[model samples]
Target: MRHTDLFYLLALQKVEGVGEINAKKLLSHFGTAEAIFAEKSHKLKKIDRIGSLTVERLKDKSVFEKAEAELRFIEKAHIRAIAFTDKDYPEKLRHCPDSPIVLFSNGNIDLTNRRIISIVGTREITAYGRDFCKDLIATLAPLDPVIVSGFAYGVDITAHLAAIENNLQTVAILAHGLNQIYPKMHKKYMSQVMENGGFMTEFWSSSNPIREQFLQRNRIVAGISEATIVIESAEKGGSLVTASMANDYNRDVFAVPGRISDKYSQGCNNLIKTQKANMLTSAADLVYMLNWDLQQPIKPVQKQLFITLEPDEQKVYDFLNSHGKELLDIIALECSVPVFRLSGILLNMELKGVIRPLPGKLFEVI
Candidate 1:
């Protein structure tokens, strides 16, 4: 966007009563923020939800000064200010109802045709959570997914670091502005993260990392990804808030199950018990559930000369070989194998080059 256009948009954001929804309404009606500011108050009041008070606030000249200052900060910091309408904006997040009108970012971040997933959980991460989180990233590394997180301690940092180690792009969505880093201790990782993926935020340069900001930050972590995975959490925490936001966005949510007695497992277990999230036992479960395998180029289906199959795999392969192509449920039913067990068996068969998975959960023998 042009500097004048961004200046007006930033000013519009500073309008007291013009929130994301209302701002969208105004932008849609007026065509541009500059046009909205140019229009008379009476004309603006004609739009739905544009109350007289909000229209009056549009006249506040002080907002323009703040917007000017923010623009200076953005220029100096070399941040990319992305509007919701931009093609480069997160595609998944653009569909969200309460997505930010503008996003500020810095780094080698790219979301085009990428498989993005958010990993969020307890700030006080445990050993089990750490191991599961690391292994999950390692297993999914082959697919080159973009890992999104809040960039906090524990699970958030764990996910980011794992993605870096795996050489996958990782995004850190912040609770505050780009001018400063939070937790102070995490400053050391800034350069590494920027090189790997980058930082993103909706907050202005003056905003600070505070309580409400974290809650607001949760939505970005959830909305920006194809799925949100909870590595571990207590009965209540910000990670759970992120999971809830992901659910509200109608995106997939996954939770790593742990022993019931573990304190951090309570939230994930509750999410599963309530049918809010899928039980994420391994990376295969995620791949199978999300149909991510279908997006990749399938290997040529030439049967390996001496590949061995487990009995269950043989049953699945025999069914597919005879049936041509069959739905996962049908194979499970005919072979008397549970769907959960059948998925792994089919994956192993695919790896052995004896079978291939089709779209819509269909399977065929090589």
Candidate 2:
């Protein structure tokens, strides 16, 4: 932000009764935030939502001075501040109905990364949620897509950390200002994220991360991404709100399934049964849903190699890796087992995401 526009922009944000929507209206009418600050009470009040009282408050010098101090804090924190008119402002977020006028971003991560996806779920994640994170990360790790989440516990933090661990850039859209990390316990992870990615908020510096702000924050998570993945959620919660917003924006909604009896899983199953989200069983499912290619040709598995396993037929995996590929006769000789029994075990492993089946009745580790 330019020096002259800095404090005035803060004043516009801090002005009493100048809500986000009306603030946008004033900006649209005046053509620049600079012009809006120069408006007289009567001119500012001309905007549809700008009430007479709001116009009266806009003339206060103290409001602008206090706002100037806020800007000083922003500068001290090494934060990036952008108005609606800034060229680098996220276009997806800017088009939202209640888009924020001034956004504060901390750290050096780019908000403009292409193909961003938001993954969110309950604060109380289950073992299933944990497993989902591991598998999903392993699958998409090679794609390098921008992963986004609210950075709350459970599914939110799982998704963000997975992306970071896999060397993928990720962003957390915070409900709080750039001044502090909410829930403070995750400060260590937040620090890692800034080193690898960064933080974002529609709210300004020093604003408390109240509950309502999260509802608004969730919209950006949905709006800014190519798709929103609901790892887990309840019937009524912010995750549902994000899924709804993703639908409204015509972005793909992908969800992971959980055990039906599990409360956390109930939301995911409901989303699937209702057709509100596409059910994904693996990372390949996600790639297919997104219509993207697998990163590269994973080496192929080839023949009836399972029959040659030594006794303890289930230990075919150890045999395959240690013994190299084998034919049916070679396998039957090694394991001294019927070819039929060995075939079944190999098929089961293929179904388990552990190995891939090959042509001419062969199998290999994936």
Which has the greatest TM-score?
1
Q: What tens digits encode model 1's per-residue C-alpha lDDT throughout 1-366?
A: 789989998998899978998899889888999999899988998999888888888988899999999999999989999999889999999999889999999999999989999999999999888988887887777778999998999999999999999999999999999999998999999999999999999999899999999999989999999999999999999999999999999999999888999999999999999999999876667888898867765434565578878888877777787889988778889999876556656666666778777756677887
| Ten residues in sequence with the least summed lDDT for candidate 1 | 295-304
What's the TM-score of every candidate structure? 0.86, 0.77
Model 1, residue 98: what's the lDDT? 89
**What TM-score number comes out for model 2?**
0.77
Tell me how many clashing residue pairs each candidate has.
0, 3
Clashing pairs in 2: 303-362, 307-331, 308-331
Residue 199 miss distance in model 2 (angstroms): 1.1
lDDT of 2 by residue, 42-159 (tens): 8777678787788777777787778878878887888888887788887777777677787888766775645578899999888877877756765666556778899898888888
Candidates in order have lDDT scores of 0.89, 0.74
